[model samples]
Target: MGARRMAKGIGEFLMELVGEAVAEVILGLLACALLLSLGLIAYLSWSFSPRLTVAGAGGLSLFLAYGAWGAFRNPSKDRRRRGVAAVATGGFTLAAATAVFLFFYGSDCGCL
Candidate 1:
């Protein structure tokens, strides 16, 4: 094949790989959000408190679940478009989880 065709082939392959990787990560984030949401719900039901964990985890779960669903389901229609969104969702989830951890277990709060 010509060089241009070869380059196009490589670009297509890379795009496909990126889409698949994003899908996997988005799915994983969805699972994490679901689990965290369930845990927070259990804690709320059992403990009954107005705390950072409840609000943060609950909000994170809601955002991730919906965002991941949109990214996972309609990938083909906008593969390149949604791929970035999937990656962003994962990144945001990680940030939210870290913030939640720091807020709940920070030295100032005395959870440790």
Candidate 2:
């Protein structure tokens, strides 16, 4: 009976470790996706008009950077933080996309 209990305890510990590892990988992937999307936003903005308005571009970039940092610092922190960061990053990205679109379609911002 004692040996069985020990085995069960060890199994539970291993399962927890695996869960944490999976979470870490998922968070890392999220970070990479944010950065990649931000890059694409920047490229599209610049492509429209070498000097187009990048109003929220910098903020969006910073948002992604901060998110990555937060994830790296606290991998095991409540999953809520990760979700919040991702949402913030997405918001910034949307802002950047809007700015780029308005720059090309809206009234001339004299970027070009």
Using lDDT, give the best candidate's number. Answer: 1
Q: Which pairs clash (backbone N, Cα, C closer than 3 Å) in model 1?
A: none
- Angstrom error at residue 90, model 2: 12
List ranges where model 2 is wrong by over 4 Å.
55-112
Top-scoring candidate (TM-score)? 2
lDDT values of the candidates?
A: 0.65, 0.64
Task: Provide the lowest-lDDT 10-residue window in model 2.
Answer: 103-112
Residue range 1-112, candidate 2, lDDT tens digits: 9999999999999999999999766655555555567568778878886545365656657776775565456556455554767776566566667556554444332222
RMSD of 1: 15.7
Local distance difference test, candidate 2:
0.64
Residue 81 CA displacement from its true place in model 1, Å: 40
Residue 20, model 2, lDDT: 95
Q: Candidate 2 clashing pairs?
A: none
